[model samples]
Target: MEYMVNLEQFYGPMDLLLYLIEKNEMNIYDISIALITDQYMDYIRATEHIDLDQLGEFLVMASYLLNLKSKMLLPDPVEPSEADQESPDPREELVNKLVDYKRFKLAAELLGERLSDDYPRIFYRHGSTVLPEPESELSATPRSLHRVYVRLLQDMLAQDKYQIPQGDINVGEKMSEIEHKLKLAGRPVHFLELCHRDLGRREILALFLALLELIRLGKVTALQEKRFGEIRMVIKC
Candidate 1:
């Protein structure tokens, strides 16, 4: 089974940072490092499951924010020079990067809009086709050509009638299935059994929520004997 995970659903750390900054109505040039870092950590902690590859960048950015905050807490070193010597802000580099990235993002959006508006109008002309001579009694008509095109389209669509698209996995339904499985086994069941490898991301998420709901309801006990071990589910008496 092929898995179709939409990575676009997740936003990068920079996007989150910008959101926080704008949400707080704070100036990008002089952001409150401590406040932003705390808010960032809250968002990170709120996420229950994350792909490590995507999470790594967020963690790195979080560390950078913390470091900036630490610097802000400390007093600046005294400068002996009186000749217009100035210390740069810790967030200067980060702010510059955010500004540049925002510019690029806006430019890409504009380009996409322009392409969408203009691309369909730019069509290639096909070479002339040899037509079959019609009998004197029969004449070719545009209506006939349109009817044939519509029939062809309808036939193409009908060919896939047997293949049904998968519907959204429901958490409540999955929870009931898990409960039935545990009752049938009369013993502990491995987590992987409940969450099949072939299941798509949406199904996996649904299964996870189902398990959590069961746990919350005190209907099942989830256990792992060792660190990084497979979770075992046992029906609660």
Candidate 2:
């Protein structure tokens, strides 16, 4: 009676051979080539509507198994006493190939499971239809008007363009000084108050950068009460 086997159940010839070996409770190291070859051929014959490409692979394994069986049946040649090592078994190469294939197949299955588990779920958001509010116009304050006038006067006076030699300003030192002043006052300080008349252009720039760094570090907060008004610096609560 011809046994019906599903071709889909086995990946290739080696897979079918492995299944047959395990089913018969045979040791992998000492597989019975005759029994395995017979079963392998049986499975190939039983499989229905088999693809010609896939059938060729099974036929190749069948030929190798037959060749190995023929070699095992051949007589062994006499060895000299000095070379007392036993002759290598003909099945060793095939066994190693099967072992490696089985290991790789198991690993592939594990990876497939992991890929399924880690598959990402996609979510889409709907677009909004409401119109955005119009931006309000900024009106200049009296303090802002005064600051503009002072800046213009300074620009007019700076026409002479004289270069003054000054040492590099340490932003870190300026930051420490500002933090100390804020702690001493225990209240908000005016931005202009930090800019003294004696301070050179680089010194003023350093102070501004230090203030910005403090704000970025969340150690201080800068607030303007009105548009173009004086910016006040206070310690962050």
Highest lDDT scorer: 2
Kindly report which residue stretches of model 2 are placed more than 4 angstroms away from their true locations once superposed.
Answer: 78-83, 117-237
Give the per-residue lDDT digits (tens) of candidate 1, residues 122-210. 44466233356877696769999999999999998898796558797899999999999999999999988877777877898898899
In model 2, where is the ten-residue run with the lowest total lDDT? Answer: 121-130
Backbone clash total for model 1 is 0
Q: Which stretches of candidate 1 lie above 4 Å from their native place?
A: 1-10, 80-84, 115-121, 126-237
lDDT of each structure?
A: 0.84, 0.86
**How many clashes does each candidate structure show, in the order listed?**
0, 0
User: Which candidate gets the maximum TM-score versus the true structure?
Assistant: 2
User: For residue 50, what is the lDDT in candidate 2?
Assistant: 80
Clashing pairs in 2: none
Deviation in Å, model 2, residue 156 alpha carbon: 62
Clashes in candidate 2: how many?
A: 0
Candidate RMSDs in Å, in order, are 20.5, 23.2
